[model samples]
Target chain A: MIHQISVFLENRSGQLAEITHLLAENGIDIRAISIAETSDYGLARMIVNDAPKASAVLLEAGVILSMTPVCAVEVPDAPGGLAAFLQLLAEAEVDVEYMYSLFTHRAGRAYMVVRVSDETALTAHDIKLVGMDELGLK
Target chain B: MANYYQPEIETASYEQIRAWQNERLVKQVQHVWDNVPYYRQKMEEKGVTPADIQGVDDLHKLPFLCKDDLREAYPYGLMGKPLADCVRIQSTSGTTGRRVVAFYTQHDIDLWEDCCARAIVAAGGTKEDVVHVSYGYGLFTGGPGLNGGSHKVGCLTLPMSSGNTDRQLQFMTDLGSTILCCTPSYAAYLAETIHERGLKDQIKLKAGIFGAEAWSEDMRHDIEDSLGIKAYDIYGLTETSGPGVAFECEEQTGMHINEDHFIAEIIDPDTGEVLPEGSKGELVFTAITKEAFPLLRYRTRDICVLTRKKCSCGRTHIKMSKPMGRSDDMLIIRGVNVFPSQIETVLLQQGYTANYQIIVDRVNNSDTFEVMVEMNPDMFSDSLAKIADAEKELVGALKSMLGIAAKVKLVAPKSITRSEGKAVRVIDKRKI
Candidate 1:
């Protein structure tokens, strides 16, 4: 699943708000986002409801966007649930570049979006896969 | 080729050149000792008199003038002539602190322009060529020095200054600028921008004179290939009348010192002992003919080697290789010496472009050096593992070359910030 996408942005005030406003105006909801900034510019990675539509809207808005396929794994809402998933990835020699927690309307279940180095190994572990719409993000 | 002062100074026999330098050196020493108070006081402290310095061989008895001495004399303390007589003033951009100002009387300016003209002619420039000088004006020495020199050579000079790349290229193409003068980094940036805008063939630039910062040999090759122009290195300091202290001849082997105007010396940077020819050390110069600020043995702090071998172009003035590093800019990391140029050389050799940043920070009282290099756009699609491997390879290369451990981070294309002028290559974050 295309769970996470990274967008490059120039580090200027109102840039992030402008990007988010454009997405909301186009009816594409953002599930979560994280920003990494150096001295001059920023890079924003976000998980959105509709990856393809969000990308198109961003492109038309004159924003550069890149999409990467990340795993959306469902885990029990317990203390070590997230830690257990990370431990599995660590043991598999897979580097997790970034991860975000995802909440769902479904009871007693939690989903996490993770972009990792080894997608094949993660998929081969038989982790539950969820789509953009199934997460109620669209 | 206008009839500029082609005094055959370069190819003059060694004995004849020595005689000319000796006569001028004695007169310059007497004038400085009698007129400049700074030199008088220094000589008094050292118990040296003008009579003691008879020839160029006796130049070592005189005291050296380092940057601190220049700073102490601040705006114009070292000038031997009155301000009204000074035709111009050029200075180094004191990005670190106060600027080191150099004054030039009409005579000094003429000599400086003559040196610059020699550099232009050596690079194949002629009266028919339009020389575009993009070195920044105002406090910076690059602009006015080249502008005056181009005019002296009877070439149509463009005092375009720097920046506004669109206008720079427009004028360069439309006006048929044949010789480009600016910092090497800016030249590289211009070349990149020109290719991106699909105007490579429109530019008529045949030669480039690049300086103001130390650049590697690989950078010269890159700029030459990208801009389709031959790049030459010019060395000078604001303390010694701007960008004409030495220039490359047609041989392009090294920059030939204007031995007629300035006396060159290579000294051990730490011990202050004069080194034999071909030894790498700090380059020191004494302005034997400068009437305004006649600095005696001003230490340039630039690390380079001098070669006395006769060139194919027949310039007998000793040639100094392009500076590899500045003594002041060397950083001590984890008990090992590190120079930004070393990393730059490694990066360029590995086929990486010159866009890199060195981040030095202290971790547990141990200095850690991290080099962040930008990947080429074509390599952006490589697998993360491959990218990581490349980064590791760079780290290993740096370690082996510098004999020090360093962390290498490979970033996406255009990730590192680019400067319109001199690129900020080093960021010593340990202070923060």
Candidate 2:
């Protein structure tokens, strides 16, 4: 299952670089990342190659990290793919908390990682649940 | 000759002061090296010894003690004496994690009481007056520090820790409290409360000693005008023996450092280099007389200017201006340095109630700062646009004051949570 890991980061220049450097140093490849911030600090949500290992690495480095399950859907790069998925989730009574589009690899196909309440509803919609291995993250 | 209470030792000449400090410095260095392994190792690493510290000028030869040093030595790491000698333990509430505890021997407590008594006397408090101590008690050092000092001054002291404003006022009126001790914000609220209840005449408060938080001159004037009392500022930290390290005399110009007990220094916050007396820098203190946990060059992080110019009050002790703000309290909002006191200054200047909250959130990788201010009942109305305009005006004022754009939301009176003790004014939702 796609897991959303919140990496607590101080709001400073090159803070992202420091975090990314730590992740790279630990060989924890970030599949997708999005940043949410407040004035003093920020939360960086990451879909990593190894959620548990990345969490441990971050924690050992004295970085506060929180894990939440997110649904990763393989959608076509064509227009309205996200809207359709969101509409489907809405109709299924699964409220999306937050989401971010994962970077595309191939010429046409794209994917999005969404944090939602009901993972069961997302899995039931024939939305293939992408894991670290499935995305060749590691 | 000065008054008997104002001892020459307390306000010794600079040359004599240096000699006294150097003597204690030598003793303290040897005491720590022989007893506290932590200090011994640190000194060994830096190749520093008791002989190297010849005077106060050579203080930089010793390492500066930060708050982290205290945390690392948690529970009782910093104690220079055996645990049996410690009579009291006071701590700062660790909103982050573990509280920083400082042990005080009975002798240490007496010294602390004497310093606080000096503060009371500096504020012109007398034995005939009733002293109301409103500093929060328990692990916090503010309450007991002042309470003991009030008793030492032979005043009828009310050890009313904090909260229960109604009872605070009732006692103020019933007992005729002439001296009030509390954080400046609470003093302002108390003034407002007395006016609200029409008990202005019933209260007998004439002077206030406010500290434990950084406040501005405007705030001092606000509290003084509202409460019909002279407000004096005091300065100290739990590590340095609580709220009696320095105090404002009747002149209210600056807080006079009790140089006999604590050697005061101004150092660059980042570099720790000692600055000139008139320059603004972080204040550091070395406890010369404290027995149990005598801190040497404890960095206070408070940004203020120190002056040796003789005050009109005739006290020869070096005076420090009211702290502008703490280096640690500087909040980085959207790449801009913002201090909560700046927001407070703006709010007070705008004629709005101080019951406000600063909310920070991240939106699209950018920091968003929002200030929510509670409308005073007298100025509130049902008109939405008018209220919004008022909020916009406040936002504009804050932007000007802090040099950062902030969104201001005017909330209904009583909407902002009222704290009986220390108010929680800053909410960084971004951290979540």
Which pairs, if any, clash in model 1?
Answer: none
In candidate 1, position A86 carries an lDDT of 76
- On lDDT, the leading prediction is 1
Q: Which regions of candidate 1 fall more than 4 Å away from where they truly are? A: A1-138, B1-7, B330-432
Q: Per-candidate interface C-alpha RMSD?
A: 6.0, 15.2
RMSD of each: 16.3, 15.6
lDDT, each prediction: 0.79, 0.77
Report DockQ per prediction, comma-separated. 0.05, 0.02
Per-residue lDDT over A20-51 for candidate 1, one digit per residue giving the tens place of the 0 to 100 score: 99989999878777776555445677888887
The TM-score obtained for chain B of candidate 2 when compared with the true chain B: 0.77
